[model samples]
Target: MKNINSKKLLPINMNSIIEGHMVIIKPISKKEINKTYLSWLNDSQINKYLEVRHNKQTINGIFDYVNSHRSRENSEVFAIFTKKGIHIGNIGVIYDKDNKYVEYGIMIGNKKAQMLGLGGEATILMFEFLFKNKGFRKIFNGVISKNESSWKLFESIGSTREGILRGQCICSSKKPCDVYLYGILRKEWLNSRKKYLNILKNIKIKNG
Candidate 1:
């Protein structure tokens, strides 16, 4: 992507609470319900680390899921789209209004979309929305120990590995695997967001 054309890198849409230089993060609509999206959930290689791996998911189930999501009052579900408008993945937060913190989850189900740092960028975009826009005090997630890249993205953005459960849950293998619990406070992000965004800006995303 070195010396790429400037036009291709420009964002095609600018409507959002948090818009990054790479991807467009917006609310996941019922319109996103379809077979193309279902294929992502059913693909073993892509869903291997996801909770849905336990069951064979279908289009009707996904359709019902999205429809149900629309009625959710505490969950903030967002669909990830490339600057070119390709629906590549979804990111969401399970808002704990009583506790005033949220659990973050992300999935770049399209294999073609992984490994380009796009996932991290999408994470940051959603992070900004939760912290900067929504004024959340803290954000956290449980990362499968085998999924190093997943937790690394959180750590890179100043999230602390609070603790680890020894073989508490299995992911990616028949054997049990530890899950790393990570958390980041708003103050931490306020201090680190600038540096992280600058580093991300220097890294170019390749068109998949």
Candidate 2:
């Protein structure tokens, strides 16, 4: 992705902290990719709902793909890691130059990481970075009709349903799957932060 403006990347001291336990979403670094991540990508359980599930993927192929896109101005990918440093998944934002909007995509490569609120945490952090740091005006996302959890996550964060693209995705069975569009504008997101924080609070209470 385009290097974040140098001024935007300046180190700043923080007095307040968001209290919670979840995956850490940070820019993808060379050190984060390894055999473990490769294996996670190949796992059928993790790739079940993903569009790129094909025959066994090679490590070299994965490396080449990630490395090739590292410098692109339209996208930014982050490796999701737990507090203990275990790699759990990845999340990314793709800016559509013509549309002037960014679309988000995320995958929990580790099955065990699913439904732990980690995805929501990573998504919130990414949204903040995109809006405050990257100066994005709006964000968009598409979720497979069958992926209820993903849809809920987006909805819980105040993304409005923009309609569905029927039979837009082709799965392994060669069957068409519907995709639901969700979007949130910068002002909408800022206004809804308290609502999202409440959702997080409820999740913590339930888990406790």
Per-residue lDDT tens digits for candidate 2, residues 73-119, read 55656677887878788876677777778888998887788888888
lDDT of the candidates, in the order given: 0.74, 0.69
Estimated TM-score per prediction? 0.83, 0.79
Once model 2 is optimally superposed onto the true structure by TM-score, how far is the C-alpha of residue 125 displaced, in angstroms?
1.2
Predicted model with the maximum TM-score: 1
Q: Report the CA-based lDDT of candidate 1 relative to the real structure.
A: 0.74
Worst 10 residues of 2 by lDDT: 7-16
Local lDDT at 105 for model 2: 91
RMSD to the true structure for each prediction, in A, is 9.7, 6.9
| Residue-wise C-alpha lDDT for candidate 1, range 1-208, written one tens digit per residue | 1222311221212125445677877766556656778889988788877888889887667645543433444565668888888888987677676888988889998788899988888887677667876788999899888888898888998899999999987676788988899999999998888877664454332222
Off by over 4 Å in 2: 1-21, 198-208
* Worst 10-residue lDDT window, candidate 1: 6-15
TM value for model 1: 0.83
